[model samples]
Target: MNEIPAPVTSVGKTLLARIEDRSAVIGIVGMGYVGLPLAFAVTGAGFRSIGFDISPERVADLNAGRSYIKTIPANKIAEMRKGDGFRASADFTEIASVDAILICVPTPLTRHREPDMSYVVGTATSLQPHLRPGQLVALESTTYPGTTDEVLRPILEKDGLKSGTDLFIAYSPEREDPGNINFTTSTIPKVVGGDGPDALSLACALYGAITNRVVPVSSTATAEAVKLTENIFRSVNIALVNELKTIYRAMDVNVWEVIDAAKTKPFGYMPFYPGPGLGGHCIPIDPFYLTWKAREFDLRTRFIELAGEINTMAPYQVVERLIEALNRRQGKSLKGMPVLLMGVAYKKNVDDMRESPALKLFELLEARGALVDFHDPFVPQIPETREHPEFAGRTSVSLTTEALAGYAVALICTDHDDVDYEAVVRCVPLVIDTRNVTRDLQGTYDNIELA
Candidate 1:
């Protein structure tokens, strides 16, 4: 192991002492899912934090002590504002005063399925002029390896501020599971990787204050690869079970029951449930970051490719099951059949609908001439999103026995906790459950069918 680089310059030493004393001013760029909670964490640790966002509306809401995310409450933001612990801004000039800056921007995939790093690159370009010596910059976005060193390093150093010597750079991927009650920003272990010793030391010191544990690795690329590996593991496991669902169904076996039995093993077993498809920011999108980068080495990520293919096709499979259930119950095709989709926010309890398979399933059902209406307690109206602009006017339908009875079939896509499964089984004539949400009502409802 190489010795950690000692802070040689006065600016570096001053910044390190401020971090130790909890007097460091922290700047969090991109105030979305990952950045908002992180800004709160840093401020809660007694550091003065500023949250930056490109959206003026988000900045205004944050400054007014209102929270857009469901998991984070307005009271928490109010608490941060009470003591002047945190403030939200759209000004890039504030970067000059901050001792450490953490970039938590989005990295989406292009229409061609390649890495679209425009947000990350644009942020770096905007912050380049305001960057000063001795400020530690860490990227928390999920992207391909070498993004920190290759993409951000040059942009920062373009104004003659060296990375390791004059300034510091690191990559620390965000592991935010929205609606997860178990772990939080402070409780989850953070992985820190740096370009060199100085960057590593600074990153560990900064993140060590916010999180319970900080796992330091050798280089920035290793840290990037760690995040991709975790998501790929999930993607591949989910794909396996999704494929198995079809096989077991053909054999007249319940896949959910098999998973319950297989999970009984005390060792070498971790259960990953099958769903309509993958959702959330990390699982559906992160694995492909590696797949795109692997092509540079003339190699292919077969597992990732296979997982993408299977997961991508899951929405179609769910629609097919719904159609089959409808035909069996009413002896009619999907044409003119009214179907109620239960839950549209991808997963339970969270309002995030990024890459949600439910939308795709809805589209397929609509194309087949099925009248589709959805009900999600978390989401009131479907917002106009980049990937799903066509669903803009759609609003959540009220769930009631009388209203549900009017539908031909109720398709369970998300299985949110707020939904009454018993009521749905009793009211709807035919029910297609993709999430095994009606497992408890298994032999009770004659019309219930698993997808």
Candidate 2:
């Protein structure tokens, strides 16, 4: 709903020229994990870049030389802004002034496990009136197959505008793995798919200017499916390991040690450890989008459903494991037990807690009448969720030994660097290591239980 600034018609046309001359003005929408880094990379690749976000605070942060997103550095953002080519705005109207528009917005799931395309729809619709000839539009949001053709194509082509000829449309999924220092936006090979040849050519030319390689696909649907497959593969694998964790626990064999021994095979094995549950932006949610679309073809994706089942049950399983561990320690039940949770972030290092299992664990514990408090150095504040009202707007406590010892059982939710594992092991009455962070410690008095 943002208004466009003054017409930079020459600047807009110059961006297309820059695409050929490697001086394109790249506009990245939704300046989150994928978008912000991409904007940085485009600027780094000698192209002018603009970062757009719906959050005015995010725009203000960029303008203030600060980065709220964990992965992007503050100086890199500042440098991009200080440079002539880079700018940040909340307005979508100025999108007409850019040659290439990359939609990096959030694609969340509805309550019924359907893909919520509001952000995608809003962005695409906003650009409809401003749709200029020969402008390349690539949807970088992770979505279902027909999203580009069915949703965006119609919305964009509403005003007698032909795709591929008048304006280019494509799909290129963002494969951003946060906290990954080795591979980045420039190094990661991009997947490009277009409505037609011209779209393909323009998308390829645009991305090729920044990225090292561009893998072209048949259609936008294929590109969309590729992203879904990547995340579904992860979801299925993690579910397999989590299910095994439960089975192995009943058999009294340590799943981690079993994985360790099996990992020695080296040839056919890829080790994926079990934990409290799935977190992060992609793996937990993307499969459901695919499954939802598959239903239209009368296809029931069993793996997708099974993965969801197993991953969804992980938090409850962690609570059960905590009960078992606590029972072993005090010869009593989880009722009236003081349980301390360690690390609430979705992953080990990053501060992102979206779809985190730790939040689920916290709610389940409180529901079972167990007193619970979380300690995560990376994530100081835990946001609100639909189900857990008790933990809404609560902040994470310090991971001190006193905090660890006060609880009857310490549940390791995330394994952040700031936690003093040795101290927790020595002082805590009982420990449930979800991420195996405290398994190797020697000071524990046989009180530590890894889930």
Candidate 3:
């Protein structure tokens, strides 16, 4: 997983020695899904970790040993609070105290679907004044290539601490799958690249402590490209399957059945199911970063852009299917009808709702004069989002026979295992299943409709 590491310089040797001795203080900026778990993972590797965030609410919640994420329990936070092993703060002045700083901030897309690096830029600017010699700074945010060398190196080195000589800078993308039980921060392999050989050595040494394996690469741009490439692969494949789902449905063929049988080949086949739309922090948004950056080289990422268009149109297709179902089977119009939305979280059983398709479905249905209500066990109350601020403060409705029977149809956007789908099919007059979660009950329930 590593080529020959550069011979440690005097400053690099000192930090390397601290990393081996379990005395290194690790600072993780941004205390959201990626940062919170990563800080604890560093602590688990026997280093004291300081979590940084701009939100007072987040800082306060962490200080009080409260866990806002469902995957991370409160007991875990309380355990981290037993001593000075872990603590969170909003003060960027403390950046000078840490041996290494890992940036895990958000990199979202703007209204134009361009890379929005405000969080990363702001974090780098805040910590630049406090950056000291002999310290290491590694970015873990998923970004386009050249971000570490082009964006951060200048701002961090602005205070006269030269990279590789006075300090070190590197890029190591975060690969976090929110609800996957099979993997954790410590178990997943890390991919690291640096501005120079010295920066690579120091950053690899830092990450080696937290993860079981460390994959060292040549440059920061390469590492950044690695993350984008991974998500692009998924985005393209999901789009392919989604397009297939539509064509197969028109021919009265089941896309899920085809996938299930095709996967039995066990070679040259990987199954990626179609969903209402792409979701989470990565797949739906990351591909467009490459598309946007391609403009620099006068390149058009037509394939990736096409995939994005397909996925983006998926939510609208769901709305159309719902409308068609209501008009044809029930002889009723979609206007002024009650529709129950199941699973508002981006994925199954996760509390995160970043870029979820359910939000778009809500907007589209409501715009068509349909009354919409959602039920998600994980997300009890909808928080304010930049994209869908109108949904803020709305709470999840109850999922029961009595509650389900009131709605004209139940549309399943996320296939959360905790949901009683059998009961949903029985209680509702029509059920639109986008996830194929009701595959087993497809024939048993005549009311089920696939979107």
Number of the top lDDT candidate: 3
TM-score of 2: 0.93
Model 1 clashing-pair count? 0
Measured on C-alpha atoms, candidate 1 has an lDDT of 0.90
TM-score of each: 0.98, 0.93, 0.99
lDDT string, candidate 1, 279-313, tens digits: 88788888999999999999999989999999999
lDDT winner between 2 and 3, please give it. 3
Model 1, which residues run further than 4 Å from truth? 1-6
Two-way TM-score contest, 1 vs 2, winner: 1
lDDT by residue for model 3 over 1-451, one digit each (tens)? 4475654689988988888898999999999999998987888888999999999999999998999988889998987777789999999899999999999999999999999989889999999999988899999999998888889989999969999888899999999999999999999999999878888888888899899999998899999999999999999999999999999999999999999999999799999999999999999999988998999999999989999999999999999999998899999999999999999999998999999999999999999999999999999999999899999999999877788889999999999999889999999999999999998998788999999
Model 2 misplaced stretches (Cα beyond 4 Å): 1-17, 385-390, 442-444
How displaced is residue 77 in candidate 3, in Å? 0.7
Query: Candidate 2 at 384: error in angstroms?
Result: 3.7
Ranking by lDDT: 3, 1, 2
